[model samples]
Target: MLIQSIIVGLIIAAAVVYGVVTLSRKRSAFSTKPGCGSDCGCNSGGKKLPS
Candidate 1:
């Protein structure tokens, strides 16, 4: 019974860590403000950079 509980706890901890890592990676992949990350001829609703 004790061994079973330990295994379950480890599985849950691993899942939580994995989810946190994935979320952070996705956040970084998105552009900071939705424009000009790749210079691929895109328009972000006529938004322009500040001079």
Candidate 2:
């Protein structure tokens, strides 16, 4: 029973870690789009779309 508990604990820890890593990798997408890239006029024309 102790081993099972430990295994469950590790699984939960791993899930938490995975979630943190995924969020960190997507930090860029979480920010504003800077109102279009250098080769476009979509976002720079006026009000930007929902992010």
Model 1 lDDT on a 0 to 1 scale? 0.74
Estimated TM-score per prediction? 0.59, 0.55
Tens-place lDDT per residue, model 1, 1-51, is 999999999999999999999999898876465555343435655455555
Q: Per-residue alpha-carbon lDDT of model 2 for 1-51, expressed as tens digits?
A: 999999999999999999999998799666545666544455566554466
Off by over 4 Å in 2: 29-51
lDDT measured at residue 42 in model 2 versus the true structure, 0 to 100:
51
Best by lDDT: 2
Question: For this target, which candidate reaches the highest TM-score against the unseen true structure?
Answer: 1
Residue pairs in collision within model 1? none
TM-score between candidate 2 and the true structure: 0.55
**Prediction 2 global C-alpha lDDT:** 0.75
Q: How much is the lDDT of residue 40 in candidate 1?
A: 40
